[model samples]
Target: MSDFLLDPDVVFLNHGSFGACPRSVFEEYQSWQLKLERQPVQFLQRELPELLADARRQLAQYLGARSHEVVFVPNPTFAANTIARCLSLGTGDEVLISDQEYGACRFAFQFAAQQKGFQVVEQSIPLPVESDEAIVEAFWQGVTKKTKLIFISHITSTTALTLPVAQICRRAREAGILTMIDGAHAPGQVDVNLGEIGADFYTATCHKWMCAPKGSGIFYAREDRQDLVEPLVVGWGWGKDKTFHRENEFVEHHEWLGTHDPSAYLTVPAAIAWHKQHFTAGVRQRSCDLARLAVDLASQIDGVHRVHADRFFRQMGLIDITSLQADPVELKKHLYDAYKIEVPVIRWQNRTLIRVSTHAYTSREDIQTFTFALQEAFNQRK
Candidate 1:
């Protein structure tokens, strides 16, 4: 609790939405900002290329990927948008995605589909998942001869379920269909190995689970697929005769998207170090236990239950709260206003759920307080 910069009065169970950075990591981020202000040209022009390369190398090694294959981006959505627009999928073509993907990333594909006259097929992955085979088979049902790519999440946002992405990626590879994994919630919460997952392209937010500062994320394109991705922003890195800033075309194209603060991106190494020092196996297990406990306590209430099997969850768990008969927006507001308990009340596929995220800083007492507030909120409506 002392390590993180969070409000003491607020019971924050929403780390999945936006991660909390530790004091040490945040200070490093500030130091980068200070350095940038001290000398703008030297920092951005003379020094940024190698600095970014070094940062990407560290991040790449951590993710089980080659340094040249990965590049820094603002967030996963930005990467998603880039791919969505770059792919040449017109009429008679299709891209497959699961129903449980992040809303923003889904919108990017949908918007591109509308403009390009391509079909965006969303396969339904119903709750109470039985097995990894079942999920793969169900999602594979939507893939047809016209399907060119598959966009899926490593861990779903609303349901908080970790999908068997490796199996799906393997199947896609055999079929020659491109694979893009939206891993916004998977980095620090679960072990991320790009080579093991075998995705053609991958995007994840360091700010969410990796505990990096906001506006820091990664976009990865496999060596063979790098040429398929076009630049979302045509900046100094574009044009054939332009001087390359980095070793590879992917980094050179995406790294310099106009002059913006690289502080968050530079601070990712500090965040990774902080994670190494503190988030040990025992600490991670404790966070997962607290998440399960939140679901267990809420399950005792009538008509409330866990959304998925415990095997599919990590530090984040989703609890069905539709039995309370209250609007999700209003219930979320009431929890914060009345109890100072911060959690997300999500409405997905007509089902209301409370998404509880547990981290190293989260206390068992905090979960209990949130449960009590939920009980009181449910009773008030009756």
Candidate 2:
């Protein structure tokens, strides 16, 4: 496996939280930063637009969406906030969300709903999901005539479940409800075709799964839905009327949000290239296999259970540790301080879960080390 640009001392298994970029990609990102420093005005004014355009084109092709429909955002949270804030929902209208959504995104929608007086409804997708169809059915049960939008996670952060977003999007379309997918964990971890999924708006973090720089993310809005949403920030992109050019609005409104750093966005193409060169389909599958092995081994321990079936997860898995006496916060701290293992122990509903994430750089030894450390921790607690 290719060596990732992660600290070797850290036994990192938290790819879901913040991705570690490849050394090559990091170097590429630094090169862009250096170029910007050399001639600030020329690089930002003369060169950035074309370079960003090329990056968008490459990313769009990879995502199976039109180049014009994609815009670089700092993160999925920002993109979700933009869509949530601009949505034209009223007091009586409802925005349906799944129970397993990322907390940051849920907060974004809640904040927006508070401002707009729209109701945010949570549709419970229970644990140990049997099949994709069952999940879809459970989510659909929450929809009503008052539903104006469906916001769901492509891959849940806390549960580490890969939701059938494409299926959900199709159903939402049939119901005449707009769909916005929070795909923070889906992009490089799995094959994602935004056009095929047919979501009205989708946001994904390249920083999480694509191994891009920390600020890299993409917001995709369908051609028809673009008109309904407005930019979160009004910058050079907005005209005197506080509106943007029809075709250019999506990119113009969202991409230039006060321009702190475009280096990460420019390096996205490099990240894509690095994944192509090192982490092929076979490599990704191997990583998933290792992650599954970790989950299986962890689940076999007493009082532990797998959060969902294999079909509901891809490169990561959540193992339920609710029966353990150890507090989730204390356990997480012990894992980090004692074993130098970095992973997230999340609390979902009433259950405590240990979310294990894997990537191309993860090895069998890494899994073994984690399992050994976990066993030791549990024994000590017992």
Candidate 3:
């Protein structure tokens, strides 16, 4: 509690939406900000290329990928927008995506599809997932002869369910279709090994679960797939340009985009270090335990029910609140205004869900507080 930058008065359980950084990582982020301000020209022009290279190297290693394959972006939305805009799609082309993907990413693809005269095919994946094999089969059912690419979430945002991306990637590869994964919630909460997952394009937010400052994310494109992407911002990286790092056209073209605060991107390694020092297996297990506890207690409440098996979630879990007969907005307000509990109540499709994200800063007492508040809210109506 003391180490995190989160407010002590609030029981902050919404780490899934925007992660809370530790004090150490936040300080490191500030130092980078100060360094950038000290000498803007020196930081941005002279030393930034090498600094970004080093930062990318560290991030690549953390993701089990090559340095050249990863570049820092402001957020996953930025990365998705870039990919979505550049995709060469026609009227017959289809992109198969999961029904549970984040809406922003889905919109990026949809917006692009509208421009290029393609279709965005969303596959329905029934909840309380049976097995990884079942998921692969169900998702694959949506793939058609026109399926050019597969877009899926590594971990769904609304449901807090971890999708089996590796299997999907493999099957996509076999079918000669490209795969793009939105891994916004995966990097810090789960062990992210890019090599093992083997998606053609993968993007993740460091701000969400990685505990990096807000507006930090990594975009990964496999070496072969890099040629498929066009730079979103036609910057100095485009056309006849002065090369900063001579690694590849991929890094040269995508790395620089005019000038923005690179502090969050540079602070990634510190966040990684913070995790290395404090996020032990037991600590991680405790967070998962608390997440499970939240779901269990919420389910025991008269009208709440667990969304999926415990195996479907890690560090974050979900419980359906449709039967609570309470408006999602009012329940969220009650949990926050009255109980000081900060949890996200999401309405996905027709089902109302309370997403519980437990992290290093969470405790059983926080779960109890939230559960009790939920109890009181429903009891009021009874």
Candidate 4:
């Protein structure tokens, strides 16, 4: 609790939205910024390439990937945009995605499909999830001969459900379909092994679950699939014979992007160190327990029910609160304004749901506070 810089006044249960970085990691980020300011030319021109490479190597090791197969990006949205805009899709081709994906990343694909004359097909995966096998089979029902690519989330945003990406990736690979996994909510919350998952393209946000500074993320392309991707922005790394920042074309082309500030990217190692020290297996299990507690407490209220089984959720859980007469927007605002409880009220599949996230910094008392506030809010609405 003392290690993080989260607001003490608020019962913050919304860690899934944007993670809270520890003071030590934030200090490391600021130190990199200060170094950049102190000697811009020396840092950017002479030292940045090696520095970035070292940082990328550390991150790749953490993600269980080869250094050259991965590169740092500003966020997962940027990585999704790069992939969506560059993939060669045309008429008669279909890009399959689940309906539970994050909105911004889904929009990137939709926009790209519009431009490339391809169809974006979304498979509906309703809640009250049975098992990972059921989810994989339900999603696979949408696949057709025209399906060229499969894009899905490692963990869903609104429902906080962990999909069986590894299984899906395996099946897609066997069927010769390209796979892109949006792991925005993975990394810190769950164990991720890129090689085991076997996705051709994957992107994750270090700032979300990994608790790095904002604007930090990673994009990974398997060795054989790197040639399929081209740089979204043509900078110093694009033209042949031009002095490149990195020897790896996949990294050099996407990593440079004119260098607005690499501080967040460089601080990822510090964040990983902080996570290892503070978020031990026991601590992570406690966070999961708290998240489950939130869902359980809320489900006791009339018209509310937990969405998924305990195995389907990690540090976050979603409860359906559709029976409440209050609008989702007003309920969210009232919870924050009146109770100082920060959580997400989502409307997915025409049903109102509340998603609660518990991290290492979340305490039992905080969960109690949120539960009491939710009970009071519901009673007042009646």
Count clashing residue pairs per candidate.
Answer: 0, 0, 0, 0
* Candidate 3: regions farther than 4 A off: none
Q: What's the lDDT of the predicted structure labeled candidate 3?
A: 0.90
Question: Per-residue alpha-carbon lDDT of model 4 for 1-382, expressed as tens digits?
Answer: 7788988899898999988998899999999999999999999889888988989999999999999999888888988998889988898999999999999999999999989999999998877779899999999999999999999999988889999999999999899999999999999999999999999999999998899999999999999999999888878877775455575788878888885999999999999998899889999999999999998988888888898999999999889887775598988999999989899998877789899999988999998888888889878867
lDDT of 2 by residue, 68-183 (tens): 89998989898889878987887999999999888899999999888999999999987788889999999999999999999999888888888889999998889899999999
Which ten-residue region of model 3 has the weakest summed lDDT?
Answer: 237-246
Better of 2 and 4 by lDDT: 4
Model 3 pairs in collision: none
How high is each candidate's TM-score? 0.98, 0.97, 0.99, 0.98
Error of 1 at 268 (Å): 0.5
Count of backbone collisions in candidate 2: 0
TM-score of 1: 0.98
